[model samples]
Structure formats: C-alpha cells, structure tokens
Target: MGETPWDKGYASPPLGEFLTKWGVTGRVLVPGCGTGHDVRLLAGKGADVVGMDIAQSAIFRAEAFPAVSRECYVLSDFLDLAASYRATFDWVVEHTCLCALDPSERSAYVDSVCAALKPKASFLAIFFREVSDYSGTGPPHPISREEIDLLFGPHFECVQSFIPTQTYPSRPVGSEEVCWMRML
Candidate 1:
C-alpha cells in the first residue's frame, strides 16, 4: 500500500507542547496515532500511554518503536476498541482524527471518544487549519471555534481552546492551527 500522507515523521508540536505543559503521567491514550510519534512522547514523560490506529500499516510501523515494544500500541480503530477495556484512560489525545472522517460521522466520533475515557477524563485535540480544499477532505481538517462549539461544547466543558502559535512540523504551507482541551 502507498504511504499515508498524514503520517509525518515527527511528533505534532502543538500537542507535544500541550502534553509537556499539562503533564500526562497517568493512564493516557493517543487515538488515530499514526506512526505513534505522540505515543512515544507521552510514554517518555511517564504516562502509561497506549496508541491506537485504524491502519494496519501504521500499527506495524508503530510496533517497532521501543514504546510499542513495551505494549503501548494497538492496531484498532479508536471508536471500536473501548469495549475491550472499559473506562481505561485518564486522558485521551486526539490529533488529526476527527476531521479525517466525513462530517456525517463526527457525532459518532465524538460519542466514541466520550465513551473511551474515564469519568471526568480530559481530552486534548489539535487541528490544522487553512481555508482550503484539503481542510474539507482531511486527516488535518481545518475547524473553526464555531465548529468546535457545535460539535463538542454541549457535551464537554472547555478547559482551553485557542489558536496555536506554532504549527505542526511538516504541515502544509498555509495551514493555521488550533488546540482545544475539554473535560468530560
């Protein structure tokens, strides 16, 4: 299979910076964790982190990471895997997953994310934004604050939601970025 363009070779800087500031030492998860870069980052900082991806190729590559060798990577879709471990994580990190799905599926994605976390768990997400076509069909979707409000605000309280100063490394030119934290 051809490579997924979204699997850039480094950790997402915005998410990484947030994890550094927020501290992820307890049970943590990285969903849609292509190549497991952020997974390694969280585990390196002492979180008992697990990474899950829908793509077998991504998981195969992820399993070779030292962190995955420690049993931190799973080959599964984030939405479908929770029944295998109930209320299992204190925190969930959503990188570029939601926007990748069709807008029709976003509600289900939100529901699935909510179901995967422990009660009162925290969720952190980062998005790449540019007023462009790629944003409309993307793993790096461009979402405005309004979209976030419509999608997540009614169900989760905002911990923080703001434009990010730095974009993810290797992100396409002309992409803007936003990061949000919501408490369940």
Candidate 2:
C-alpha cells in the first residue's frame, strides 16, 4: 500500500487530549502506529513508549521519533507479539488501527491488546464515526458505537467519548470522532 491516507501528520486531537488527562510518563504502547506521530507526542511528555507497525518503512519513520528510546519502535504485526513483551505495558493506545482492520478481526485485536497490558492496565482506543458508506471494503472500515460496546465491554470499561471540533487536517472535514475505554 502506498502512503496510507490515514497517515496524517500529527497525533489525533481527541486522543491527544485524552492522553494529556490520562497522563504520560509510563510504559505505553501504540500498536499499528502509522508514521509514529502519537508515539512522538507521548514521549515528549516523558512517556517510556513503544510504537509498533507492520510496515518496515513505518517502523523506520517511527524509529526517528526523538522521544522513543532506541529499541522502542518495532516492526511487528500486532496480532503476534513476542512472549517477553506480553503484559508489559501500563497502557495500549489505539488510534485508527482497529478501525482500519476488517471488522471480523476486532476480537483478535481486543485479545492482543489485552494480552499486552499489565494487570489492571488500561487501553485507550479511538474510533471513527458517521460514515456514509458501509460495504465495509475500506481499510478504515467504520465502526458503530454498539459494535464497539459489544467488542470491548467484556474486557474493558467505557471511560469517555466525545466528538471533536477538529480532526486530522488531511481527513475529510468532520469525518471522525473519538472514544476511549480503560481495561477492567
């Protein structure tokens, strides 16, 4: 795939706001972190962070993140994490990653994230809402709130959700919103 249109230049606003309130400066993981923008932002706030993506080029771009430690960025499929890293993070923050996957894969996504968290650790996931198209062919395959609730409710607690006054500058105007949940 050529440049993912989802790779807009900065950390997502609603997510960024959530992180700020949630606190940085601890073990954190950003899975499917395209271009590592949010990882950079998290690290800037003193978070000890890892940014993982399936693309080597994306990993290369992420490795340049000033705040991520030298070994922090890894090129790996989120579904298959090594044993040593299991339950290793205080938080796992998902941007557009889960939404980008086929809906059938959402449970595995939830499992992988759960396995990666420390006991009682939390996860923060952002979903895009209000799409007009729904044959579900998109890499961005949009998700409804009910689907989100069902998939994550068993393992996590809904924390907060809100619509944004702003979105990634490159994305279509008013095309997305953000919701965050914490691990139970």
Candidate 3:
C-alpha cells in the first residue's frame, strides 16, 4: 500500500476531549489502530495500551513510531481475536474500525469487543456518521446513532453521546458522534 488513507497522523480530537473528563485506568485495547496515534495518546494518559490491527504492515508502521512507555502494537484480527486477548482490557477505544467494516459484520465486531473488554469496562468510540456515497460502497459505511445503539445494546449501556466539538477540519459538519458506553 502506498499510504494508509485512514492514518490521521494525530489522535482523534474527540478522544482527547473525552479523556480530559474521564480518568484513564487499567488496560486499553485499540482495535484496528492504524499507525497507533490513539494508542500513543492513551498511553500518554498513563494506561497500558495495545494497538491491534489485522495488517502486519500497519503494525510494522505503528511499531516504528516511538513508544510511550506502556504502549505496544500487535497484528491481530478483531473479528477473530486471539484467545489471550479475551477479557484482558479495562477499556476498548474505537476510531475508524466500525465504519470500515461491512454493516453485516457489525454484530461480530460487537461480539469481539464484548469478549475483549473486562466486565464493567468502558467502550468509547468516535463514529463516522456521515458519508459522501449514499449509494453505499466503502470501507467507510457510515453508521447511524440508532444502529450504533442497536448493535451494541446487548453488551453495553450508553453513558452519553454527543456531537463532538473537536473534529478533523476536513470533515463536514456533524460528521461524527462520540459515544461513551459501559459494558453490562
């Protein structure tokens, strides 16, 4: 691949906004973490962070970056996560993974997250809720608020959700939604 299109180069602003209010604790798992921007951010917040992606190239790129003490990058598929990862994290932080997946795979994604996070652990995500292609074809199939609730409801309870004030400048207005949920 010439370049990772999803590589934001910096952590999503909403994540930083969320962290300002919430305490980072225990272990954090960032699935589909391309280039580890969010992993480094969480690690800086003093959590043991793991950035996991299915692509080895992505992992290699992530590893090349300077570590923030407790952060590590791993090559792992979120859908069929390794057994060792089950119940291993206190928090699961998501960025582009949900929209990148086919909508049909969402339930499996939720299942994997539920399995990865420990009981009562938090799951925070900054979801892409706007799409240019209404015809629907992409790694980025945008998600609606209702669908997000329906998809994750069985395993998590929503703490709060809001339109983030901090967003990428290139994105359209209201292109994202920040959701904070706790595992049931």
**Model 2, range 26-145, lDDT digits (tens) per residue?**
798999988888888877778788888998988877666565442378888998887867999988888888877888888999899999998888787667765656566777778777
Deviating ranges (above 4 Å) for candidate 1: 68-71, 131-140, 169-180
* Candidate 3 off by > 4 Å: none
- CA lDDT, every prediction? 0.71, 0.77, 0.88
Q: Listing every candidate in turn, what is its Cα RMSD in Å to the true structure after a full C-alpha superposition?
A: 2.8, 2.4, 1.4
Query: In candidate 2, what residue range of length 10 has the lowest lDDT sum?
Result: 62-71
Q: Which lDDT tens digits does candidate 3 get at residues 1-184?
A: 2466667689998888888888767899999998889999999989999999998988998999988889999888999989999999999999998888899999999999999999899999989999776578887889987898788887888897888888777666588888899998
Q: Which residue pairs come into collision in candidate 3?
A: none
- Candidate 1 lDDT over 1-184, as tens digits, reads 2567776677777766675567766788788887888888777777788888888878889887765323377887766765865577788888777767767777788787777778888887776455455635554556666787787887788776655555555564346454455555
Error of 1 at 47 (Å): 0.6
lDDT of 2 at 112: 94
Query: Candidate 1: deviation at residue 156, Å?
Result: 1.2
Clashing pairs in 1: 129-176
- After TM-score superposition, what is the CA distance of residue 163 in candidate 2 from its true location, in Å? 1.9
Tell how far residue 73 is off in model 3, in angstroms: 0.8
